[model samples]
Target: MSDSHPKVLLTGATGFVGGRLLPALLEAGLSTRCLVRSAERFRKPGTGGPGFETVEGDLLDPGSLARALEGMDAAFYLVHSMGGRSISRYRDYIDRDIRAAENFVRAADAAGVKRIIYLGGLGETGDNLSDHLSSRQMVGEILQSGRVQTTALRAANIIGAGGAPFEMLRYLVERIPLMVCPRWIDTKCQPIAIQNVIEYLLGCLLQPAAAGLTLDIGGPDIITYRDLMLIYARARGLKRVIVTVPVLTPKLSSYWINLITPVPAGVVMPLVEGLKNEVICKDNRILDLVPIRLIPMEEAVCMALAEISEGPGRIPSMQSCLIRDV
Candidate 1:
């Protein structure tokens, strides 16, 4: 670690979590460079944020990645492929995600980047793991396999405005009075608020104890997906009738969700499958390393609703057109 402020690189800076994290890094007085395919999307020509700059790069492009990573102390790997626009494109997400991770690892190692912090999906690892969960875990493993000190923070269903899960719940609950859901609604999940997620991420950057560790971070409440929807319904002051049917498979659920919510069937595939497993935190080491009062699920939903009052979700036009991995 450097004695002075560390220079960090942020990937997926325009996505849900990355967008929120960039400003936080800048506010903390760290020189943060965002890696983007198009720099113009991050800032207008000849204008930039204090302590922040955008580098034209892609994880899949090794030459560009090396340039973006050069002289960086640490980096955040927040990039994720949301299946794709159509079913055919969705088929290659696992391979695409893996290749990108491999490219990143090689680039970071060659660049001599000391630390890599990654936000990965939370789920049990085994033969039963969903394609989404397995791919996420594989990406984390890929980052850790490199020479750098990697901190992998696994989280389930991050609840906040503009997030895919929140957006799905927002549209589904707001639109349908009678919601028909699969039986997996009873699956337990420990979801953290976006603010808490950012704090934990910053903690991993500042505190060396978090390096080379895989940790789980979640909220104070460990509840079922059904409870999550009820909480949202209650917060919105709307009464929803949730019907759970055993016959509905994950594929069917995804399609139904796609039909009703902004989240597309492709995006919902992994999400609904992820819900089939219990995603509650297995340990709280991250809290011990970087302590904060975890927000309650009800409060988290209320806060998300407050942002909705500000207007529609702030996803880019393309991202909004389909459901995304939260």
Candidate 2:
């Protein structure tokens, strides 16, 4: 609202999206503070450069949240409880996420935080949604219902190195020559690049018109899980045969993914459950408000591969990958 840059407080600074978003936020010249569980864990000697600092806190603690949000112009609600390594503990993720969001809403509202930006899943809201996707949407609702202005950016599977969806796809195609898939393989989803997601999040903060709105963000291509598998296969110069089986439920599919990928079953199960439902963007208003060059699936997969690859095996880009043809 003023000529001076707003002070921003970022939660989940050590998370998948937050980890990446932190650098982008600092580089864009905002005075940034990270609300991390441990300052020592999220900070380094020169990590975030100028106008960056860290505050130790937890979302579940209202006092800590108050301390973190005080004097901050904007904050990001990026915390999610689904990434734990213990499979047995995943059952509590939904409840914990709900509580955390409630705390954040109250704390932010009381502290007079000007705006909040939440990154949520891109699934249709209804009674039949998976627990993971529903929890994400519920958190958005919790934040939006508060007195503080909130911008919710919903996106489907984000393609990037070390991300759950990308890791599952990468390891699956790299290891499995013949995959026994379920009916959800054909489910439609609009995937977005991690970089694109970062840009949209940054754009929302700068564009005040984005306040108190829910926006769908996705890449240029909308494809099925089967199409993504095929694209990953092509990118790596490998041949894969996927045979669909109607009876292989989400549990079975998650088990299969757990055995194949480095990602834990705790994380894969909820994501696998979400695959049964279509997750394409409902609208593209964000494209007009925060215009960005969307990265297609082909290029996104290649970019992910390049990140995890070593010196001799890197696929520089989609067009330059020698095996992208077949």
Candidate 3:
């Protein structure tokens, strides 16, 4: 690594995507700093390693975020609120997501940071977007408002150990032999693997083309939620059946998911509602810029399973999967 290598500030370092991203950023030889809520969390097994500097901070608090943003060349915004009980009542969700982005942007500007990289969801803009996707888009806008260059990577269902989509698929396939699928099940989605997402994030750090841009990243295969379940079933060596019923609204589907999977009604509702919209990437601009060979869905699923069998904390698994589903 050159002396000119950027010192990167990473938020959400304890979360699923951030946890996976930490190792990748370290391996890439970048000078890395992580913003964590509690320093004690960093002492846990599989949390820290060489090349990481952990600082305590809270996104909800601008002062803390400003302190964390000091002396960094760039920052990654990877936080989201899905575990909350009621998505509708989460004023803090919007406030924290938007305000945190804004504060980070302002702090980065004050610190003379060069760029901001954010990971958001993939969905068509307009009224069709779910609350989660809408908030994610808002975060991107907030970050871009600052003078610093911002790169936003929008992805559809990310398939990996510790990702929400993978955990949902795992639970649904493992728990329910016969799934009563909703209309969203047939909706098309481009699911990217965790490895590919990490690749894209790393690529952004070096690719000038990624600056001040929003890029869509997806896997090589464009498949449906139904297709995802089938692939998982085949991978797990379990024969399962899906019965698509037309009358099941997103609300009812969420209830069903809550019953069958480890995902709560709050998380499942937005995720299910979002599935109603097809999430396939509309452009290949990212390919021209990052030029990564996307992994196939089957291979991604196999890798996730392999990680799961190896043991806990090696891979990020949903709390629900470990406690309720598995």
Candidate 4:
């Protein structure tokens, strides 16, 4: 590894956001190493590249985490298992995340890693948050408790292909002509583009002010979940009618989501519950700090649909508006 670029240890390299971030980090001249449960996960076609290495490790295994964190400058903690079939119970997933964070923090501190960059969920702290959002915030707090400087970027629904949120909206609008939405669909949120998210994650690494900070990263538009489905429908050239019904419980909504969308019941339940709370960003300090143009909801939806049509490409470097963080 070269001494010029930071040696970054990236977890969740095989997951949606991490998979996109992996190449972006490398393109930004960072010396990258990924921590995966199995090294073979990176050996598939279009998954390998030069100037990056993979280490076999699991966040639950202290020994493996220690080995993985050795001689790393910073670590990107992007692991979450909300949608996994192995999560028998939602509460069990929360416990797993906390345990993993504890193990990772201990190992990172022992290895003398400088910082930890985390992507967490967005929602006001005392809003009777759902188990899924609560677990996300808890993991961020656990990461901050460690000796290393931690930067946790809390973001709302990310509009990107292959993401759970995007897939859910995509399937619902594409399959159903007239849909019955729950009351939670009216909850307000600031959905961001996946491209902008990568920019923020990369920006945090390059900005000294980002250390030991918890920032809200969101797109320009503030809209409800209902608006999101409508925007996605318009972008895909589909005409869909949505009617809100207050009688549907989270359990029933989850079953309906499973029947309509490819997302399973286990994943659908937590997500549907999370939609009950408003997740709009309360702060906009990231705009002044990072200086990238915020993509609007409609434009973001169109871009996401375009990505799905053209297939994935290397995420281009976002032109920075400010040369240095003030």
Candidate 5:
């Protein structure tokens, strides 16, 4: 690593995507710092060594965010309140998200952070947008409205081991020979592998084309939720049948998922409801900018499964996977 690398701050360093992203940033030779609510939770042995630091901070606490953003060239915003205490209703989550995003925007602006890179949910803006997806988009908009340049990457159904959505799909396919799915299963999505997602994030760091851009990122495959489950079954060499019924409401579907998979209803509801809207990528601008060999749906499934069986905290091999112009 060079001595003059850009200093970067990463929020949500303990979360699934952020956890993976922390190391990827380090591997890319950036001087990385993580803003975590609790330092102990993130400071495990053999991690955050030279060129990395962990700062105790909270997005809701502007003072902490200001301190964390000090002298940082860029920051990755990956924080969300999906299953917090005030989340009885979906709007509650939205309100909390808005509050946190506003605080981040103000603090980052005050500290003169150069750019804000955010990962938000994928969905078209419309009346039918679920509260979950709407909130995610709204956060991106709030970050973009700030003084700093913002690169918002909207993604759908990120396929990875131990990810909430992938775990839901994996457990459902593994445990059930036949599935009773809601109409949302037929809704189309472009699922990306976790490896590809990290690649895009790393590529955006110094890529001028990604600045001030709201890009949609995903794998090469456009698949439905039903197709995703079936693909997992095929990849795992399991036979399964999916029966899509229109009568199941999002509430009912969440409960169904809760009963079948280890994912709780609280976490499952928003994801299930969001599925009612198709989340396939409409823009391929990221392909031209990042230029990664997009993984296929089945191959992503296999990679995710391999990670799951191999245990946690391991990213797929990157020896031949990465090709960056920077």
Candidate 6:
């Protein structure tokens, strides 16, 4: 690749956010290389595109990753082990993420990659953090271990199609007329649209200011899960009541989620536990650095609904399943 048009390596191209991001990267006229576990999984027969390549590699395999990272200017680390059956054990989840990140970072460093961009969860910097958030933070730390500059974009609930929180809200609202809400349902969270998130990720790729910084990304509004349910109910023209009970623990909530939604107990438990922490954005440093118009909650919800209604585009069902499990 020419110096003017740097080659970028992207991990998790078959994932939910990565699936949306691939078209955006192509549209931006950047040379892109995606790493997938299976070559067949990354193949798109009819969609002909230039400056796009796919290579079979796993984060666990250092040799394949080193080859994949060769000649790449920048890399995007978008992989997470949220859907894995072993995520129920906090130590296993942390170990997997840390090891994967370490391997990727070492490979990127050896390939002389300029930068690494990571997407992580948003939560307070305290010992009381949920396991999911803790693992995300640890991954960010692991990525920074190498000499390559890393940018960590910590975000709260991302409101879009194929996201866990949004799908959970959709299932809860669509399945039950009345919700027996958990205590965490009232906790505040800042939600950003999938569009805005894509913009932020791409912005970091283009903006020099985003290098080696941990920036918080969120929407213009902050609302509780209950408030979100009410908005969704209003949008769908459904009347529903939420009865909050302090007795419903994360374990109990996971069991209920398994029964009500398509999400499994193993996946839902950690996500439910994470809801205990309020994940609102702490500062707007990213907004000042990489300026992009933020989308409102209602508009974001509408766009997600439209995308869901339109059926699948380039995004795969496996990606959707993985996202819901997250």
TM-score of 4: 0.91
Q: How many backbone clashes does candidate 3 have?
A: 1
TM-score of each: 0.93, 0.92, 0.92, 0.91, 0.92, 0.93
Cα lDDT of all candidates, in order?
0.82, 0.83, 0.79, 0.81, 0.81, 0.81
- In terms of lDDT, the best-performing candidate is 2
Tens-digit per-residue lDDT, 77-146, candidate 3: 8887666666465334656677777777877888888888999988887847877788888888888888
Per-residue alpha-carbon lDDT of model 4 for 1-326, expressed as tens digits?
12347799999887777877987887787878989887764532243467578899999889898888888999899888665443246556778888999999999999999989999999977899998899899999999999999999999989877677877787788888998877988899999999899999988888878888999999999998888888888887888899989898877887777777666555677888899888988877888889998899899888867666654433221111111111
For model 4, what is the alpha-carbon lDDT of residue 287?
A: 87
lDDT of 2 by residue, 1-326 (tens): 45348899988777678877887887788899989887765543244666888899988787888888889999988888776567667778898889899999999889999899999998887837898998899899999999999999999999887567877888788888999999999999999998899999999999988999999999999899999999999998999999998899998888878877767667888899899889988888998999889999899889877766543123222111222211
Clashing pairs in 5: none
lDDT of 3 at 166: 77
Q: For model 1, how big is the CA root-mean-square deviation? A: 2.9
Query: Stretches of candidate 2 above 4 Å error?
Result: 43-47, 310-326
lDDT per residue as tens, model 1, 1-326: 65347899999887778877877788788888989888766632122367777789988778889889998999999998775447445546788889999999999999999999999988888748788888999999999999999999999999988788888887888888997788888888898998899899998899988889999999999899889989999997999999988999987777777777766556766677677878878877987899888999999888877765655444332243333332
Kindly report the root-mean-square deviation of model 2 from the true structure over all alpha carbons. Answer: 4.7
Which residues of candidate 1, in runs, are more than 4 Å off? 43-50, 312-326
**Residue pairs in steric clash, candidate 1?**
264-323
lDDT tens digits by residue: candidate 5, 1-326:
12236699998887778878887888777888889888875643255568798899988788788789999988999888776222256446678889999999999899888788999989999849998999999999999999999999999989877677888887778888988888988889999998899999988877877888999999989888888888999998999998988898987877777777665555677888898999989888998999999999898989877766654435322211111110
